[model samples]
Each structure stands twice: as structure tokens, then as C-alpha cells.
Target chain A: MKQKVYLYRAFERFWHWSQALIIFFLALSGFEIHGSFSFLGYQSAVKYHNMAAYALVILIIFAIFWHLATGEWKQYVPTAKNIKAQINYYLLGIFKNAPHPTRKTVLSKLNPLQRLVYLGFKILIIPTMVLSGLLYMFYRYPQNGSIEGLNIESIKTIALFHTAGAFILVAFVIVHLYLITTGTTITSNLKAMVTGYEELEDTTKSQLESKNEVISAEVNNE
Target chain B: MKKIVISLVLIGLIIISIISFVSPKETKQSKLNELKAELSKKTTPSVDHSKFPILQKKIGSPQEVTEACISCHNGRAQEVMQSNHWNWEREEFIKGRGVVYLGKKNAINNFCIGVEGNELSCAKCHIGLGMTSSSTYSYTDSKNIDCLVCHDNTETYAKAPEKGGAPDQTLDFSFIAQHVGKPKRSNCGVCHFLGGGGNNVKHGDLETALFEPSKETDIHMASSGMNLGCTECHKTEKHLISGKMYSLSSMNRNRATCEECHTDNPHSETVLNQHTYKVACQTCHIPVYAKVNATKLDWDWSTAGKLKDGQPYEEDDKDGNHTYLSIKGNFKWGKNLKPDYIWFNGTASHYLLGDKVNDTTKALVINPLNGSYNDRNSKIIPVKIHRAKQPFDPVNRILIQPKLYAEKPGEGALWKDFNWQRASEVGMKEVNLPFSGKVSFIRTEMYWPINHMVSSKEKTVQCNECHSRDNSRLAGLKDFYMPARDFSPVIETAGTGIIFFAFAGVLIHGVIRIISTRKRKMKV
Candidate 1:
């Protein structure tokens, strides 16, 4: 019987959930800060938004360090093998209860599609929010200086980018919520994140084939 | 063969991915240090030019303040005290007809100075050099609100406002931050915290600072909280040891030219020249009055709203003299305006707008004066999508009449230094009705007088006429409404971020796959 291995470390789980919560608060409080919905009123919402942003930044710093030291960063590196198959399974095969073509193993857990998406989240979306947020926080009026050599009036662009990043986060969350449901038992995948234990299916014939191939290849070489 | 090729490609991809993932920063540590050094700029404390010993005193001490101030602006002094402004004393009334005594019953208005006697707290508003001194402040010096008193940052004055003018700059801004772009609304915010005072007073047409600028508003009500500067309009030279016209009068005393973009002839040269009012035309023409035509009706009414008493309104079918008073508020014009004529003439210039409403529909024309018009022939003004309206049309309320203002392109007499327009009544303190604290606005005509605009709330009311545009007051709130914006520059910043990572990831994966494939092929 195949059991879900101890793949994600304790810190990884902590970082994941904490990062998610912080991002969620950031988006919620950020939009409120924009006067989208007055949940905490304007001032309080601003306070929360700034706090969550700082918290998020701290998480990101820690995450960077963790990824570097553990070298688990390999998990997010995009791969082409079975990528099309993985995409196809998500689009068509999943509905038919087809098994994931790219299995989640201890060495290579994520499929190519996941690796690509994670890469995007790490590189693109994450940085967009971080940079835009920093720009928003540090944006200033020059009492005796020009704004970036370009004397163009208004910081509306900074505002627009910040808002756009917020919307992107919203979209990511919507899609993520949907994707989280498509796990093994809906409950099974969720339970893994919650309890760090996934009831993975038994190892299949491919492992046996690779094992035999490895033995025979060694014998043949001799 | 296919399996071997696939394995080789996958192995090669893994190797490159490993290396690329290991490094994200392309710049070396030394280069990063250099860049950091390039970005950091040094800052120094502001230099104070004032010689008044009080400038360096502890603020808010009664002995240092009240005693020192009254000596020069003495309550007991005669000739200097006669000027209504200097007579900071008043009596209050307990009740009935609100006895218009020499002063206020409450100390608030300095009724001794027309303040409501008990409300003496209001006396603290007029700030200046001797605020904290024990000896009487030297009143012989200009008593006008000193610009330096509030705008304390003298060291890097120019940097306070960015290129076009915005509040986006901070007091502690590095030189680099100012060079890039100014913040939109925070510049004037620190001192303009209206509610922070012991008494919460918000004196302005716009809502509280806590509220957002409504989306429905025209660019005229630009978000005041964003990129803000004190001197886009109000430039300063020295403290007003000699009384200086507040920036509001700067445009008139040394009239600031109208916006260059506003080149159309609202004021015909003949009428403009004939009407030798040195004040900005906006002052009297748009000044809030009981009625534009000297017609003071019993009730306050707008052309759009009902009577203040919650009574429904009915207007005469045609333009006629209101022989009798009605429930609707009177439509009083400024000093020489004719509301009756304006009401009748405005019928003709209805306009059409392209994209003011919903996605496909046109915008509806609303009253720009924020006043209700007398219904014509009982016909309601057409409020339709894409429909045009008053205020935008030159004919509606141009400066030609009342002839208070002028626009000289180059070197007209009025168009000179300190060309600030007057301040709105929002800045006025009703010490005793007509004779009030008209020290002019603290900032320039272009810059909003956020201080006065946020102060002087309650116990006194400034009709929109009082707060409306006037020669004394430039179309400050108007300019503040519509700031310019361009998005193209930042879009690339967003796009490049997304694509860079995606491409880098693909390149790493592809390179690793190819290398693996080549090694496997050679092994075979």
C-alpha cells in the first residue's frame, strides 16, 4: 500500500499557511483601504493593510532563506516531461477519475504544470505585489525635488498598479480555491495541507519497471 | 530510442534548472552595494530664518503665549485695538434674538471679538510668532498669519512640491524620492488634520478627510489627499513681519494669470478693461450671497432643491420678479450678478457629453452651481444621459459680468509676483460677522488652504457663496479636482516582471533537457 510520504517539512507547512493568511489579509485589507468595502473603516483598514504587508514581507524573506538552505526550491523548477499529460489530466482526465500522470514522489512531487504555475507565483505575481506595494508605501511628494526627472503630475499610475496587483491576487485565490477541490478526495488533498498526511495510492508498475531496468542494465554492462 | 531520447532531455533539463534556481540575483554583491550607495541621499535639518525669540519658544504655554501676544495686540490698547481684527474681545448672550452684543455669549467667537463669550477656546486659532512667549508679542510687526508659522520647513522649500504639485512628497524625503515623482495627497495632510483639534471642525465643501472622493465627482474635486504641495500656487519669500496679502490676494494684488489652457474669452476685453476690479473675477462673481440679484428671499433655496423647511417647491412659469417670498431659498448673486438674467439665459446653452455616464449612454447635465434653478414654464431641465449642462458653458457664469477678474497672458499689471487669488470663506473666521479673520489663505491661490478649509466649523456657517470661487479665491478646489495621469510607463514594469521569470524558467528547463539528451545520445 502506498502512503503519502513526509514530503513537506514543518517549516514549509508553517510558511505556506502563514503566507496564505497574510496574502489573504493583504488583499482583503488592501481593497478595503481603497474604499472598496468598508470592513474596518478607512483608517483601521489602512493599519491592517500596512501591517499585513510588513508581515508578508517578513514571510517572504524567511521563505527565500528557507528555499536557499533546503534546496527544496527544485520543486518549483519547471519541467517539460509529462507537462502536456499533466495539463490534459487537469482539463479532461480528472473528470474521468484518471490518475495523475506525474506522480507526487519524495524527489519530484509536483507535476510540470504545477512547477510552471509555482514558478509564476514565485517570480511574477509575487514580485508584482511586492514591488507595487513597496512603491505604494514609499511613494512621496517632493517638497524640493522633481518626481523622477519626469515632472509628470499625479501618482495615479502607482495606484492603478497597486490595485491591479490586488485584483490579480483575488483571481489567483479564486482559481486556487477551485484547484484545491480537484485533489484526490477533495478532502484528501486538503487534509494533507491541514494534517501533513496524504493517503497516496500504492506505487505503480513504472517503479517496478525502472527497478528491473536498473538491475538488468547493470548486469548487461558487466 | 524514444525513451532514451526523452530521458536524456529530462536529465539535461534538471541540471540547468538546478543551477538557475540556485541563483536569482544577476548582479554581484559589489554591484548591489554600488547601486544601494547610488540610491542613498543625505538629509539635513531645515534652517529657520526668523529672528523672533518666540520662534524658538515652547508652544502652548499661556504665560509665553497669551501674555506675550496681548501686549502687542493689546486688548486694552486703543488705536491699534479699534481695527475689528485687533479687537479680539466680545460679549455673549444667554438667549433671545441672540443679542448682537459687542461680543459673543460663548467664549468660542471671542465675542469680545464677536466670539460667543463662553467659547473662548476659539481664540486659539489665530497662530503666530509670540504664541508661547511670556512678554506681549510685538504686534507692531505684521499680524497677518505668518506663512513660516505653519510651513516650517524652510531648508528645502522647493522640494516640498514636486514638478506639477502633489502631496506625495514626505517632509523627510531624500533628494532622489523627490526627483522621481511626488505623492498625490499627503503634503498638506499633516497640519490639515481637522478633527484632531480639541473641537472637531471641518470647514470645506468636500466631506471629511476620512471619506473618499466620490467617483461621481468631476476632475474638479480631485482627490485632495493625494500628491499635494504647499507652493504650486503659494510661494513665500520672508515671514510677514510686514503684513502680506495671503496667497488668495497674491493673484489679485499681484494677479496670477488664469490657467494658460483657459484661453477662451469668458471676459470680453472691453468689459474686462472697463470693469477695473483688481480682485480675481471669481471673488465677487461667485461669492456666496443670499441671492445673485440682490434678491434676499426669506428662505434659502436652490434651483434643484425644495425649501429648507421640507416643503415641496413650485416655481413661476416664466422669469418674473419675486414680488413675494417663497419657501425656496433665495438665489442671490454675487456683488453685481443678476440671478434672474442668469436663470433665464442659461436655458439656451444646454450641452451634450460623450462618456460621462454608463458604458454606452451619455452623461446627464446637472446644475454646476450646486443650486436649484427656478423651473421654467414648469418644464423640468432635461436630465438625460450624454446631456450637457451649466458651469461648463462659458455663458452660464463667466467673468465678463461683475468684472472682478482679468487674464493677461504676459505682463499685465495684475499678473505679477505672488499672483495668488483670494481664499474662500472656508478660510474666514467670523469674529463678528462682516469683520472677520480675513487674513487671506495661508497657502497660495493654486494650493488649497487646507488649514482654514478644515478649521472654523460650527457656530458659524459660510454659504456656498461665501465658500464659492471669487477673485479673492482662485478656482483652487477646481484645479485640485482634476490631476493628470498617464499609465503607459508603469505597464512595462508589470509586464517585464511577469515575462522575465517565465522565460527564465523555460530557458533553464529547456537547456537542462537538451544537455541531458546530448549526454545520453553520446553514451548510446
Candidate 2:
């Protein structure tokens, strides 16, 4: 039997969807500003990119506080116990219709591999983009307005880092999109995210049913 | 928890608003106090000239006035005669270029041509009296020196044009002579501000506004802050000014520079101090010039004779800048101009009267600021590049200074008759230079170094101004690589190649994993 359980909270859904929208908008505008086709024009694209970046920062700050208050940060605490199983499940086991090594619950929403990848994205890629973007925005400062002879290595470094981080994020998003489709049904996982409720197999209920039968048989023998 | 987050956000925004609004007002108040303190340090001239008996005498010619002045102040006229202001000559052996004899007298400029036959008009700027075309003036004569041009403190003394450098006849000469004292900013700017015929025409950095300037116009000469006079930086010896014009200077040593007062290591950071080796102080300090008035950017002499029904026509551009004028040819003027950057080692090479130019398609450089990025002594400096299209001899391939000003009409003056050939021949004859009689307008450029109208540190250009990728101000400078602005093709290729290989590896890995998974599933 399958039972529906509440998964993502209301604020969590809001943060996730808003962050996704802002990132998508930022990527579209940023590429346009980088002279890739230029649909919105360069000037308008730059303005939109800056506004989206600020929106993303504000969302990130709010999401951080929410995650801490709800203690949902523990979901991303990665462990190596089910790492091999999860990798095999995706590589070969999933093709043969094997069961998943790690079960989803309210306390443990993300699997080990998902936790590791998301943790890297959160701690490394996102921060790198934010910091490098800031440095690129204010590259000429800290010289006290005497910029004539100042050598600006910081600007070049920031540009390279920001570009590299964007590529990493793009690759992560591609893999994440593919992994989300690996659920029991294509629309099932996406529906769970929208409604904040997921239907998982009642494994504990089945175990208790078998134990109750043994206890009844023992009582008959007595 | 949500309320707490909202409250924190609101508080953070309030703090930002307060800082953005209130801090600037505090800084402005402090700046005002600093300026007031600076002004209190200066003192006006002490020696009153009104009580002197020698100055009270009635004067006939300017020479007589000079004679009476030199009787009391001995050797003063001799000192004035030795200066470049009086002699109009600069002789120095510059490096790379050989011994150069160049000055305003011989240096051919695009504006008004040379001063050979037009001495009566040009001598208005001269420090001597009665310097006409036919006048056999002796440099040794003290009576020929003009004393009132510099020492006048009454502010009423004015020079009459085409009067052999004499003062205006209506001016109270005795009163001006009585009030003679140390030169003010007005006295120095009377000729300099009005150089090349009108206000804000030549030397884009200087203008009449500098007489009672604000801190925004000039940091050093501001009435409130520093209150510096011309002599502060142009420190003179025996009435000979220390600074030389870029069109004439050839000497290689001891020119007035910001490093003389402000040490090379002015910045707090050591890295910034090290930059002084390759960058000039004025480049950052005076980010722009011609802040107070519009300066002449270019003059096209070929369009001088354009007329509407036999009357001289004048036109203005979309920006209200003077684009065409029949009396003074075509002109392009601009205010608050950005300076072109150059590497200069404090020396300039001028195109003397007979010097051959490279080509007519390109501008003949009246004077080029000499330096290279490879030169250790060179520093990046800012300059106002004034472009002009003036007459040059096609046969000789040299610039010809056609006499443009004439006392009367149709006397071989380019302005009067709009005849280039006649004016070129007559002007060349006066200077003893041969002319082939073939005159063609050629583009020419003069580089004027920016050294004034410095804004406060807060008003300077921001960092992205130069480091930007498109339409950057520093795009023309290619000697030194600017990060984020310039890129290496090899490095870019390698970086992109790495990313491509990484993406390919991920695709290959995913394909292999899927192939193995499919085979295992088939066996099961």
C-alpha cells in the first residue's frame, strides 16, 4: 500500500521556485549581454541581468534563514553509506527495475548522491558566481579614486571564475533535470514538488503485518 | 520566524538608505572647512606702488613708460627681455631629434598661420613695445620692454590690438602704473586665455574662469582651496618662466611636474606607488579638460570662403557647437572633453617651419609628445589632441603658414580675399621660405598636455570606465595589456578546449553507463 506524506513546506516551495525563476532569468539575460544573439538588446539585457541578480541574492538570504529555522539543512548532510548503491541503481539496477537503496522520508528528503551534488552547488558554485560577479561590478575601487596606474588583476580573475562557475551550474542543471525524470512516473516527482506531498511504499506497515501473523500463530501453539 | 526575517530585512534597508543619503552631506561639510583653511594661508602683495614718484609721471608712448619704470627698478627690463615671453625663441638639443630652434615665432600652427608678416596683429601677445613687421627692434633695449602686462594689479589695464602692444588709450595709465604689484591670475590669463584670437581657443586647459575659479574648475588655483597663483607651479627665475609650451619645449630636464610637490609615493598602498613609474599624476588627477568653457577642437580652412548670397554664413551643429563660420573658417568646439592618453617622457618634438610632413592624408603633427611604453622613463599622460585642416604646399610637401590677418582688404591676406595662392606666396616671402605656389588643405594635429582644471578625487572616473569591454576609454592604448579588456587567443582557445573536452567526457561516460546497463538488463 502507498500512503501520501507531506514533503516540501510552503516556504520551501516558494524559495525553490523563486530561485529557479531568478536563475533562469539571469542566465538568459547574462548570455544576451555576452553578445550571444542579443534578443533584448545589450543595454536592456544588462539592466535585466542586474535586477535578476539582486532578486536572486535576496531570495538566497531568505531561503538560508528558512532552512535554518525549519532544520531542513540536515537533508543535505551527505553520507557515503548508500553512495555505491545509489550509483549502481542509476547505472544498471534501475534498468532491471531494482528497488532504491535509500528511501525518502520527511527527515531525509534527498538521497546521498543528490545531497553531495546539491551541497557542492550550494557551497562552491553559487558562492563563486556571487563573489566573482561582485568583483567584476566594482573592479576599479579600493584604489581611493587613483586608478590611473593601478594594475587590475582582480577583474580578469573575477571574469574567468564567473564564466567557469556558470558552466558548472549549467552542467549541474542538465543532470538534475534528467535525474528528476527517473521517478516511478515522469509526472509523479514533479507533482510532488508542486503539491508538497509524495506517495511512498508503506514498508514499515508491511513489516508489522508479518510480525502480527507470527505472534498469532505462536498464541495458537500455546 | 517569518516576522523576524522581514524585520531584519527592513532594518538593513533603512541602514543602507541612511548611509547613502547622510554620509555625502557630512563629507561635503568637511570639504568646505578644508577649503577655508587653505585660503587663509595665502597673503596678498605688500609693496604698494602708489607712493612711488617715478610711476606718477605722465607717459607718452609705452616705451617712455617702460623707461621711467626701469630707472627705479634696474635690470628688471633686462630680465623680461631674456624670457621666452619676450624673445619668442626656444633653442635646445632634444634626444632622438637634433638641435631644435622652435618657438611661437617660427612654429607653424593651423590657426592664423605664422606671425611673420602679421606682426602688428600677433604682437598684441608680445611683451615688447612697437614690434611691427618692419621694426628693426633690438632685444638689448630696455625701453622696448612692456612692464604693465604682468605687474598690473588695478585690473583696468588693457592691451590695444594692432597698436604695437600698447595699452588701451582710454585706460588711466598713471593709475595702473601706481597700482603695479605682483601678478594675479587675471594678469597671466589675459593673453593665455585669449590665445589664437579668442577665448577658449588655444590651450584647452586654461581659460578666463581660472581667475576666480571654483574647486571644480581647478583644485590648485581655487579661490577657496589652495588659492595658488601661476607662479606657484611655474616657479620663475629672473622673470623667465619655468614651464614651456608643448609646441615649443625641447629641453629634457627640470620641468614643473606634480612630483615636485607631491612625492612619487603619494598613495597609501605600495603597489599604487609603484605605478608612478609608468603613469603620470595628471592622467588621473585631471581626468578631463575644458570644464568651464567650450574649446576649439578642429578648424577647417578649406571651408572659409563659403558664403550665402555674398554674405558670410555661420552655422551651428546639433549640439549647438560652432560648426561653420565664414570669418574664421569651420570650427568644432566641445566642452568637458575627455583626454587622449599617451606615453610622454617630458619632451616634445615640434614641426618647425621648413620641416617635411609624412603625407597629406594623415595629419601633420605640429608637435608630438614623445614616449613609448618600452621606455622606462616614460609615463602615461593625458593630452588634448587638437585637429585642423590647413593649407600646405603640395609641391614641397611642407606646411605653409598663409598670412590670414591683414590691416586692409585684398592685401595678400587669406581672410580678406579668400585667395590661398597669393597669401601663401606673400607670407613665404616675408619669412624667407620658398613656396611652390601650390596650396592644398592638409590635416594637422597639435597635442596639448592637460595640467589644470583638476577635480576632487571623488569626481574622477570609476573603475569600469577603462576596464570595460566595449567602447572603453583605454581601448586605443595597446602597448600594455589591460586585464578583462585584452585577452590572449591561445589562453582563450585552451580554456574553451578544456570545457569542450569536459562536456564530451561527460557525454561519453553517460553513453557507456547506459550501454552496460542495457546489456546487464538483457542478460537478466
Candidate 3:
């Protein structure tokens, strides 16, 4: 039996979709600026890329506040438990019709592998991109009065870092899209992200009941 | 679900509003336009010189008129005497080559070689009245200054060709002297526009079209635009002009810059404003030079003296510009030309007359505008490069200063006798420089910075002209990194490879998963 459960919240779904759209736009415009291709023309590409960057920054600030306020940041705290099992399931078990080694619940939403990847995205890739991009935007040629303590002589290094980060982000989006299909059903993850609801196995109900009993015992003791 | 939809719509609306609010808008009014508008208001001169009593008498000569003018304006003649226009030279301290007096008197150009033996004919443009030869003319005589040449309001004042800088015999000196007020565009254009023996032959930006120019010819000098005179931007004080061409000047001082009128940060866009640090205003403003007239691009003196049936002849192109002359040589002219870009730091070094030719294998740079991307003062500027193949001394390793002009045919002038050996000997003897008795043609180049014929803002160089991958305006400048035009091959290749592989990997993975699932379903 399958039971429908509320998974992603409204704000979380909004942030996810907004970030996806922004990243895609940034990639398109950034690559155009890199002279890889011409789409919106060079000037327009630069203008739009700069605008989208600012939008991404604002979105990131709001997402950070939201994560901290709701304690959703803990969902991405990587753990060793069931990590190997999750890896094995992806590598071999999924092809042989084996059952998942981990179960999803309201409190712990991500599999261990997903936790590690999301944590990496938050701590490493996102910060690197943001810092390098800000430097690229604000860096003045030394002849034009320079920023204090940031005597950057050239934009070559900053541009390279930003371009490399863009490539990494594009690659991540590709893999993330493919992984979205590996859920309960081919479209289950996408549907949950969109509608904030997913159908899980009935075993989650027993787990919820046990948690409720523990909460009642604690209340009686108090 | 309705709440989610409402929230999403609200977020989208907020983002759209933010973008619309922060995006840059087209500025309707700019400070430069306001300044131009203010300047366009015409002002009549406070005193009309047509009623002056000192100019009523019949003037004997152009020099006599100068003497009469000095009787009232006492110190002005002394000021003119000290100017570069009067002495034809100035004291300049060149780098590596100590303090030297440099000017047209001793300077050599690819066109017409030098002014040593050709002073009589060349004096048609000289400010002074009597310059029979370099050795005999008295520069100290205050009477020699031609006051009406610059101060003449009557456009009829003209110096006859090869008349030792004397006014045309037919001109009424008394009428011109009475009408003298201030120099008009025609006075400067008379000599400057006709430099190098023809209209618009030397400096590509300066031409006869500038006298009553339309807006497309020049914004500043346009009759219908700002309508500025030569003295407006040149800013003369005590007869010493503030601007000096890098070809003639070796020092960085006394240069008129765009910053003098329009501040350095003149752009509405921050990115463009920042570009002022490395790019000159002329680089973008003067997109194409020689706008209305074609300027001489190449002169090959090696082909001179090639006559049909021993009679000197000339050939003109469809535009009436000279293509070949039996006396001068073959010529190439360019119209509406895009200028070459270079890094200039206001300082330049000239290959002066008698300066030994060090490299014969390459085209000699007559005047090198010194700068590099690493220099703090350097900025990229547009320049018109005039190339020529002129006579040189291969044995002495020096450029030959051949006599080009003479009053009569038998005077050893190359134009008269068509004999390079006698002309080179006489020219070298006049300048007190040794000649090898052997003349060879040498390829040489001269750089003339384009500072006029400024286009309107709408027609200025676009961003893609320099920032694009193909046919960039700055394609020749490779010292520094420019975005879109420059990138590391290693990083670009690696990044592209990673993205390509990731795309292929995902496609293959999706296909295999589909096939495997189908097989499992069939077995079940």
C-alpha cells in the first residue's frame, strides 16, 4: 500500500525552482560572454548575466534565512549510515529489482549520498562561484582607483575561476536532472518538488506511529 | 496548491519588478550635449576691425603691414617671434638622447624627404614672409612675421606657391590688413589642409572639408554643430599653442586632451567610464578618418622620373586624386579608412635627419609613439600610418634628404632635373651631412594620430567591434587579456570537454536504464 505524505514545503519548492531557472539563465548568458557562442549578443549577454547574478545573490540570501529559520539546514548534514547501501542500490540493486536500503521520513528527507552532494554544493561550489563572480564584477583596472587591499592587476584569474564554476554548475544540473528520475516513480521526485506531496510505502506510517507513542510517553512522564 | 501558486506568482512579480527597476535606462540628456548647446550660441566680436584707421594707407609689403601692426600692439610681435610657428623648432629633452632642438627645420618625413634644400617652395606655408633659404633668412627680424596670415578675417589672403612665403602679388594688402580680426577656419585650413603638397594629403583627419564641415565631417568644427574655431580647443596663450603632434614632439607636455573639456569620466555607463583609463576617447570617437576626402596612404619615390616620351606626366584616379606623377612617384590614397590602433603614452621618439638607419630589412619607423600595455600612462589610440618608399643611402645606413623643389629646372631639384645623385648630393651638402653618392629606396612608415572627424555618439565604435572574437578592432594589440577576445586554451578545452562528456554520459545512462527496465518487464 502507498500513502501520500507532505514532503517539500511551499517556500522550499519555490526556492528550488527559482534556483534552477537562475542557474540555467546564468549558464546560457555566461557562456555567451565567454565567446563560446552568441545568443543575446555580447552586450546584452553581459547585461543579463550581471542582472541574473544579482538576482541569484538575493535568492541565496532569502534561502539561507529560510533554511536557518526552519532548521531545514540539518537535512543536508551528511551521515555515514546507509551510505554504502545507497551507493550499491544505484550501482547494481536498482537494475535487479532490489529494495531501497533507506527510507524517507518527514524529519530526515535526504539519502546519505544526497546529503553529501547537497552539502558539497552548499559549502564548496556555490561559495566559490559567488566569491569569484563578485570579484569579477567589482574588479577595476589598477589605473582606475583600485579597491583597498585587493590590488588585483588582471581579470584573467577571476574570469577563469568564474568560467570553471559555470561549467561545474552545468554538469551538476545534468546529473541532478537524471537523478530526479531515480525516485519511487520516474516522475515522483519532480512531482513532489512541484506539488509538495509524494506517495511513500505504508511502512512510513508505522514509523510515524512509533514516534507518536514515544512523544506521548514523554508527555506522561512530564 | 492555490496558496503555492499565489506565492509563486508573487515571487515572479517581485523579481520582474526588481529587474525592471535596476536595469540601466537610456539617458535622455548628457552634460556634453548641454555644453555643446551652450557653445553654439553665437557671439559677435566686441570690436570691428574694418573701421580701424592704421590699415587705411597702402601697405608696401606683407612685412610692412606687420611693422605697422607692432606700432600699436608692441609685445605681441615678440610673442609671435618666440612661438614654434615662427622659429620652426622647440627645445625638447628626448629620452636617451639629451636635450635637443626638434622641429620641421631639421625633422625628416617620408613625404618630400626634408625641408633643408627646399625652403623656398616649402616656405609657402611658413608664417614668416622671407625664407629664401635656410641659411640666409633672418628669423630674428620682427618685420618678417606675417600678422595677417593668422589674423586675416578676409579669406582672400593667400601666399603664392614658391614665392618665398610672400603673399600673392594680386592680393590687396591694405584691405586685408584693415579686415584682420581673428583667424577663421579657412586661415588654418589654407596651409594645414594642403599639407604634403595637396588637400588632405598628410594628416588624414585635417582636410579642406573642415572649413564649412557638416556634422558628419566633424562634430566640433561643423558649421551647423558646435562651430568651434581652431583656437577654441587649441587654447592659445602668448602665441604658444597648447597642442603638439607626437610626430613632431618628443616630450609629453603641451598636449590637448579630451579631458580638458569633457571630464575623464564622461560616460553614463560605469564600464565605459572605466575604459578611459586604458583607451583614448579618439579610439572610439573617430571611428573612420579621411571622411569626405581621400588621404595619401603610400608614396613610392622609386617610380619617379618614369616619363612618357621624356615629358613629365601625371595620372589621376576616378576621384581626381593623383595616382602617379613623373616628378613625385606612384601614390595610393584611402577614403573613409579605419585607423590602426596603438598604445601611446604622449611621449615619442623620432628618427631625425642624419639618424643612422639601424635596420634595413624592415620598414623604418620615422616616428615611434612610445608606450606598452604595462605602462601606467599608456592608452590605446587610433593612428593613420602613412607608408612610403623613399631614397636612402645604403652604404652610409642613413635616409637621404633629396632636394625635391626648385624655382628653375637646372638647380639639381629632383622635380627639375630628375637626377637623384645630384639632388641627394646638394641636399646633403645643404644640411652638412655626408652622402655616399649611392641612392637606394627604403620602405618607411609615419604615424599620425587621428584626433578629428569625431563621429556622433550614435555612430561611435560599438562594444562588439573590440570585444568580439572575429575581426576585432584591437586584434593587433595582444599584450593584455581582453574578455571574449582572449581566453586560456587549456581551461576552455578542458571545460568544454567536461560538459560534452557529461551530456553524452547522461544520454547513454538514460538509454541503458530504459532498455534494462523494458527487458525486466518482458521477463516478468
TM-score of chain A of each: 0.84, 0.86, 0.89
For candidate 3, what is the DockQ? Answer: 0.43
Candidate 1 residue-wise lDDT, B132-248, digit = tens: 211233444433222222333323322111111112223322222222222222323332333112111121222233223322221222244221133332333331112211211
Give candidate 2's error at residue B467 in angstroms: 1.9
Clashing pairs in 3: none
Residue-level lDDT tens digits of model 2 in A1-222? 787878877767767777777787877776554433446655456555665676677768887878787777867876776799999997667666677888876666788898898899888989998888766655545433455575354345666676667666665665666666667665667888889988887656434565446335534653
Best by TM-score: 3
Worst 10 residues of 1 chain A by lDDT: A138-147
Give lDDT tens digits, candidate 2, residues B195-232: 88777788889998899899999988888878788987
Candidate 3: lDDT of B365? 93
lDDT score of model 2? 0.74
Question: Each candidate's DockQ score against the native complex?
Answer: 0.02, 0.06, 0.43
Model 3 agreement with the true structure over B1-524: per-residue lDDT tens digits = 53655465568658775765554434424567677777778778887665777778877788778988999889998899899888888898889888889987678898887788888899888899868886678888999898988988878888888877888867888888888776788888888899899999999999999988999889888888778998788888988888977777898899888888888888756667778888999999999999999999999999998778878999999999999998899999999999999999988888888889888899999999999986778999999999999999989989988888888888898898888899898888888889989999999999999998998888899877898788889999998878888888888888878888888987887787788899999999
Q: Which candidate leads in lDDT?
A: 3
Error of 1 at A33 (Å): 2.1
The CAPRI quality class of candidate 1 comes to incorrect
Q: Write the per-residue lDDT of candidate 3 for residues A14-105, one digit (tens) a residue.
A: 87998899899999988888877888987788877887887788778878878898878878867776889999998778777678788877
**lDDT at A144, model 2:** 34
